[model samples]
Target: MSREVAIRVENLSKLYRLGQITTGTLTHDLKRWAAKMQGKEDPFMKVGEENDRTKKGGSDYTWVLKDINFEINKGDTLGIIGKNGAGKSTLLKILSRVTAPTKGEIKIKGRIASLLEVGTGFHPDLSGRENIYMNGAILGMTRHEITRKFDEIVDFAGIEKYVGTPVKRYSSGMYVRLAFAVAAFLEPEILIVDEVLAVGDAEFQRKCMGRLKDVSVNDGRTVIFVSHNMTAMQSLCNRTIMLERGQIKMTGDTDTVINHYLNTYVSTSSTKVWDEHESSGNDYARLRSVKVVDDEGVAISNSFIEEGVNIETTYQCLEEGSKLYVSLVIKNQKDDLIFISSSISEDVWSMNPHPLGTYKTTCKVPGNLLNDITYKVTVFLIRNSTDVVYTAEDIIIIEKTDPGNNRRGLYGKWGGLVRPILDWRTIKL
Candidate 1:
């Protein structure tokens, strides 16, 4: 038997006008008239360098998504992974018709239901029971079908006591649980889910994953899941699709695709900096710059675990007479914080005053301390235990390697924040 295509997207693109009024207005009308007469797209449609609002001088009309093309077969579970603003949600939105594409075409078969946000089809004034039925109908389910799944939906959501309560009264977690329950129970031919599970508790997320697995494997449905949680994505998806700046970066087997996405799609060191002029926030000072160097004092962009290296972060004090505290957080490629050390931890400074000037702090990561993998560094500045001057996350990239293990243990099952090499003793048991 030949495989059936559940979804086919060809040259799909989405565009938006930057720095313009979205709704009707006299100014917008005049601009549109002038642009049409001049035979131009939109005055705001200037294609060039992209800006990151998360950083300084970022672009206004950041392309949340651009041209994208992919195919998902029946019963295939496709995982979408990328950093924030990589257009993962935008692609899923276009696929589910929550938003129309700016260009290209998409062919989808059977009924499609998307759980893009909490209380998606739910009316805040309506009771839970009513919203379930309403959402079921919206998903193309008949009255009888909804009736059969009503109890299971309520039970799975674990909100039986508040069945008749207005959805507005429900907490965020409750709202998502009820909304997800309705979407998942209806058993649509194509299921589109965003990062809804991220807000749920750990146990709830596990339960939802289990139910989704059953739906895709046993019921032979197609699923498109977008999430930042790499471990969960790897566990649930057989195939993976990675997106970067609205373009498809990689698509292949789950492990290979996810790894490629992590290694390649993540922010490069040269692209991200911790300069004081570029980065600032509440609670602490600002990170002036971050750099890594070897024993010979040569600047290094990447390093192996066996190479002991020096990591340095420069900071600037914006105000005088404020307690200064700074921390360095190291995380693995999965975005999990491995170790966080702060100036407070060392007790190097008391109520002492720090002059308003630039200063650099360095930490040494000795060889053999870290296993082979990609890691990131985040810098934070705190003042008086409450004020946060600055916090810059995922600003630096570090690579580690253990030639003896052959990279197998680097992605091993022994999960934790760190993979340390401690001495062991075995007395013949």
Candidate 2:
């Protein structure tokens, strides 16, 4: 059996004029209108460059998205990831029909309820209760249908006391909560959410994630999610697409796409070194180098999951009697922090002050402890156990490969941020 497509985008592109809202002067608009009447392409569409914000282009036009083609299958959850200004919101808006694409077409099979931004569909003068019904009506839900879900929506949003208040007076968090509740409860066939969820509290965010997953899994609805939180993306989306400068750079399983984005777009390396003239530090201490090493103390960027790796940092203390300690923060490709270790736990040097001299701190990460993924290491130097003196953020990147030796015959991708070989025993009852 073949899967049905929920949404199909073909040759989708969006172009915008710089420093102006309208397309251009009335004369340009007339020319575009004439071209449309003549069944010819717009004259200005061929003059713009890709939407690269860093570089200066000669033309006044820029393509926010170009040649974008993709399909979302029914009941599939899709994630869109990219750096800032990568045209993520533009694509979502186009799909939601909030804006028209400059060229190409998008065919959608179901009613789309979008939570694009805070208060996107809510009326400021209207009460939350009124807005809920209004949004439902816009989604083609009957009054009876909206009435049936009204209580559940208000209850889920935790705004029972303020449901009758004008939404303009609501806090940003409340606006998001109620907006999300309305969008999710309206029973739209397709749901589109942008990074607006970040405005809510952590608990509310978790609730939204749970609801998103429930709608896709239990209700068989299609979902498109956009977020900078990699951990959330990994947990919610089975497949993901990475956008670079308004184009799809890669699309595949969540793990593969996320790993590629982290390794390729993110600036990281296996080793970071500062010369004698340039270093990262204050007046008290200076960082010289940070790197990942093998058991033999040789620098290596790649290692097997079964072979533990070591992180080493070298620094020099400029002042005598400086109470300093080193700390290491390890994060996976999904940008989820695995663990943080500090030398302040040491018994001898932790409490005592240090004399002026060069020092090396090594943290041993045992094998079978970390999952097979790319890891970024950040080094922190603290003085007097409270003040952070020097910091090297994401300076060292390490890739851990799964050799299958520790799989114990099991196959497929292992779950969790850490894959430790814990002790387990079982007996038949």
Candidate 3:
């Protein structure tokens, strides 16, 4: 027995003009003309540009995705990862048939359902039920197929009450719920999901992941997922693809691809200082500097497993008698939360209101508690526990190089979020 190929993309490339790509298709051009003659906005016109943000693009034309090639096996889930302007979403759009490639062709075996972005493939005035039937019909499913899955979709979305409301009036979270439900439940052979799931809350994210696992494992459906959440990606995907500057940077197993993507893209920093003009804060307070130091209180980017880390943050108070508390949430390379250390929990600044001055605080993280991996610090400053003064995600990266685990075994890497040495007492029996 042999596995079947579900999707085959060959030399796929998409060229776009700076502001908008003019449709070269004759039928679309005629449709635009007809729409204009009818005194309505041209339905063919959509506004988007190539994703390059590194510098001012020289030419008016750019290849958003170029010469990309990959093959997905049936019943397999592929995870696509890249930074901004790296052509992650563009690839998904091309796969979902929301857009066409300028050069090459994509050979897909069966029907495709995609939730590319919020409110995509949905009409503004139509109810959720209408959209489900429409999507099913578009995917070549009959009305019976849609009707059989209607209640399941509604229950999964948890929007039974709002199913009658127009999707345009729904909140962003509601929009994603309905969109994902329709795409996942309507039974398309291939599922193309974008980062729209990021809009959902944490619990919904877990539920969606579970559903995705079932679709791939039990139903033998192929899926392509794009997200910035590495933990979800690692858990759901058997294979991974990384895109960079409209090119396929790497395609391999999940671990290798994720590690390469993170290590190649991780920023090396022990401190981040913001100038007043460059400050991302408001009038209440502003961040002065945040640094990660070693055991001796010296700042460094690279640290060993035996040596602990000390994180320090400094902020300048602009208003007098303003209450500000700082905290740091740490995560590993896979975006797994290790722990959160807060000034309020440490009884440092929760009881006092600071005057207009510079305040510096530090927290010592013990060694041998964390596995050797890249750690990121998300900084948060809150007032009254409701108002967020300033919050920065992954502002500082602490690279922990493990010298050795001292374990005598064939296992090369320790498996867990943290590597804490547990206390054990043995009694002779």
Which candidate ranks first by lDDT, i.e. highest?
2
lDDT of 3 by residue, 331-425 (tens): 87666678898888666566368888888888888887777777889899776666788987788988777777456554677777777768879
Q: What is the per-residue lDDT of model 2 for residues 32-103, given as tens digits with 9 covering 90 to 100?
A: 899999999988888989999878899888999999999999999999999878889999999999899989
**Candidate 2 TM-score, true structure as reference:** 0.63
Comparison by TM-score, 1 against 2, better one: 1
Instruction: Please report, as a residue range, the 10-residue window in candidate 2 with the lowest summed lDDT.
Output: 18-27
lDDT of 3 at 284: 81
**Model 3 global lDDT (CA atoms, 0 to 1):** 0.81
The reply for model 1, stretches above 4 Å from the true place, is 20-31, 34-64, 121-127, 134-143, 164-175, 266-285, 290-314, 320-330, 336-355, 358-374, 380-391, 397-429
Off by over 4 Å in 3: 1-4, 19-52, 118-142, 155-179, 196-203, 268-289, 294-296, 301-308, 313-329, 337-372, 378-395, 399-429
After TM-score superposition, what is the CA distance of residue 19 in candidate 1 from its true location, in Å?
3.0
Measured against the true structure, the TM-scores of the candidates, in listed sequence, are 0.72, 0.63, 0.66
